[model samples]
Target: MSQQRIETIQKWLKDQNAEFAFIQSKANLFYLTGFRCEPHERLISLFVFQDKEPFLVCPNMEKPLISQAGWAYPIIGYSDHENPWELINKYLSTYSFEQNIAAIEKEALSVARHEQLQNLFPTFTFVNCEQGIMEMRLIKNEDEIAILREAAKLADFGVEVGINAVKKGRTEMEILALIEYELKKKGIAEMSFGTLVLSGENTANPHGHPNTKQIKEGDFVLFDLGVVVEGYCSDITRTIILGQPTEQQEQIYSTVLKAQEETLHICREGTILGDLDRKARSIISNAGYGEYFPHRIGHGLGSEVHELPSLNETNNDRLQVGMTFTIEPGIYLPGVGGVRIEDDVLITKQGHECLTKFPKELQIIHS
Candidate 1:
């Protein structure tokens, strides 16, 4: 499985005119090597070339695990206190890559590491490879899509548990506990983000953390959570009303749902992101909730909760088939509550496919 990904990366490196590329980002490393490692002050980096086999440089303690993964690459281990620059320089010299241009992940490479590399090999040239690699990962392959689908299914089940657990006197923290418990029950080891269970006026905060405030009758209940399954992530949000919703709340909920549905309808391959965002924002704005809708419509999702090809009015990138992202639109009223409905979407040649199958209609749960 990893061999195919390595071959694909090699082809991409050749096309980009890169002599060699270094990958240090934890998520990218997992994608390329199928070996997961915790990120720490001690860096574990991988080097790949167009024709040669990939090589990994890490602390001595990690060699056993790396070897157990059955990677067909050379593993170079160094002492914990030893300078990694010395080992890297020796390896490069042995490979006869002196003075060659090397592509480095500027986003992940620290200034300290950069300085060490420069000092070790003053003749070598370093180029920023972050964008090149990110572009390659933007589109999801078949395996990646399958994992994301499973993640979405698990997230839907978690949402169902959270909604049912909502009560008039339950605290926001209790609701979050129920959501996480349900996620764990479905075999989700880690969440894409912390569970957000906001009630009443606290729902107005888009990224607010759950607190101990008890939910009141006739208050809005917001849930934004996701789970990581097989390295891919699934993110979704659903808002419900406790008891009965007022006329204004009902109107706001309807407007947000309409915006989400319209956006999904127009999102497809070859569509401009800016236009897609406008289609959703225009619906809310036309409904007289322009100021309430402040954030972007959505963002790309994959190994990371947020990746590239953001969906917003400012983004002009054209949508391509196999791209996956979220479509979340909300309205926040200060001193009141907010309503946000989000789902995972995948772009296809024919049109857009909604991966999240949760009900979008506002649920009125009597306390």
Candidate 2:
């Protein structure tokens, strides 16, 4: 972890008056310790507190890999079969932190793990630390932004391939398969979410999954996908007409594009996120498509696909520089297909930078 990050954690611990914080989420663990270990039903955890170096606990089998990650902390490895709670408790008992409040990741900690920890440390109070950690990571740093930029670039390349794959006689599943293949070819090992390849009336579903229905002429095709790079994520969506678009299809597409463009122009640091959502939604609403635009304008993107500072009417979190998220607005009409345009954007000092630079103009693919 960087010195600045460590200092930030220390300040947060001080403000919260916490003796130590136990982080078990794989993504959070990687963010703090710079060690990328799978949290696969195992008790790989990290403990950090004030005036003390952080400590990592993992199975002995993972020691070599953990060591290579260059974590500036003590790595305590126990046998896979040994009771990890017992080992952790023994270490805790030796310290003077008895009866002190220890913050634990409430959201990510499984019930079984929480019960085990409670039983082991009956004297210490365990409090929720998930929100505290999330607050810390909501804003991106320089290194995180760089990773997100690269992830967006990779998604752009994959989108081009996916758009080209849409053709007459091709199934939605086949188009998705092609996108996945291109993502892998571009070295993206993980997808932020399942690839959504919706066609025709299916496009009315915002979260539609790829199906076996074959593509045909004059059908609307929507591609919503993202790629994960070094634990950071990027999301982008584009809608295309398989053949020539009908008059109504063209109208809906133009309205959606105008809304997205206007919202993008107004996005900047300190702007109320909900205001951005409303700006785009008002356009669709005035055009009599408000009911079709059901979901929020966008969401924060980072280690986990969805983070803090949601772009919605209910959220009042002000945008800050270094924050990266998506700006997606759509108009979905049931039985009439839908049109959506989305892009990954980085909040900058002046305005916002569009990371997903792939063409958003409606493309007409011929047979």
Candidate 3:
């Protein structure tokens, strides 16, 4: 755990006149405490104070794991049968606050949970702390960039596995399973999200899922997957052709690749973030495939697969050094197959680094 981060949030709480801040999201918890756990339906939170030391509340069973993750603070744990809110209230009630204001993760907290907190502190005024936390997490430190590079290497390996698994008559689900199974052998415990291996017409759908559709000659196979390493994530996408490609297929593939590369070429500090999307969109539009292209250029990547600083045309944020995100450009035709090229990019003092190093050239696999 970084004491500096803890102090940073405490300073923010003081500046906001909030006595304490409740961090409930798993991603934020992992960010602050260095402990990663998926407590589905279980109460787990970190309470930071403006003038007092902080404490963590979680299921009693996870106390040891949290400590093992190097959290040096008071841990208030409750069993499944106990009311976690009561424990939290009893512990926090010891401190007398000058103000009744507290900060909460408005995005992660549910109405029921808000009511529970309200019942505990009847006069407490809850304010949104999610945006503040996001601002802190937006920039990548050297250590974080190191972990992301490793994750990107693993994501590249996953794509390699998927491409090699493609075979005549093999179903899309079959190839997806092969990719994850191979990754597990290499010590990957989890993927950032569902592994996607779309074949032929399935590639036209931006959010296609793997299924029993078999691979065949003259099909465009797309692999989009990522792996999580040490709480960080890497996302990548690559599309390949089975057998020979027609003129239209080659044009679409080349257009998407050009769009991705041109956008990546302009990445650096002080560049308008939205212009990256505009750059890619213009390339696709000039190629007469604008209507077929949907979605933004990309999104920020870090502890969570999809995070802040969205790469959309509407956002006017400037790209800063230490900021990491994806530069993905694609063109999807409804009846025909589509092509996408995605890379995890990190803005550097000089220019930018493409973390995911899997080759982007269109590969034609002989079926």
Every candidate's lDDT = 0.87, 0.85, 0.93
What lDDT score goes with residue 229 in model 3?
95
Q: Model 2: how large is the Cα RMSD against the reference?
A: 1.7
Ranking by TM-score: 3, 2, 1
Q: Estimate, for each residue in 1-367, the C-alpha lDDT of model 2 and write its tens digit.
A: 5456666777777777788888889878878877765758778998888768778899889888777776767887888688888888787776776336778988888889878877976767777877877787888888888999999998888789888887899999998999898788778788989989999999999998779999889999998889888878889999999888898999899999999999999888878888989999999999888999999989888887888768998777788898888889999999899888999988889889999999988899998
lDDT tens digits, residue span 1-367, model 1: 7788778777877776666788888878877887777859887988888888889988999888878776778988988788776888887786755336778888888888888777865777888877776787899999899999999988888889999999889999998998898778768789998889999999999988789999999899999999998788999999999998999999999999999998888888888998878998899999999999999999999988898878889888999999999999999999889999999999998998889999999999997
Off by over 4 Å in 2: none
lDDT of 3 by residue, 116-210 (tens): 98998799899999999999999999999999999999999999988998888999999999999999999999899998999899999999978
Could you tell me which 10 consecutive residues in candidate 3 have the lowest summed lDDT? 88-97
Cα deviation in Å at residue 345, candidate 1?
0.6
Stronger candidate by TM-score (2 vs 3): 3
How close is every model to the real structure, measured as TM-score? 0.94, 0.95, 0.99
TM-score of candidate 2 against the unseen true structure: 0.95
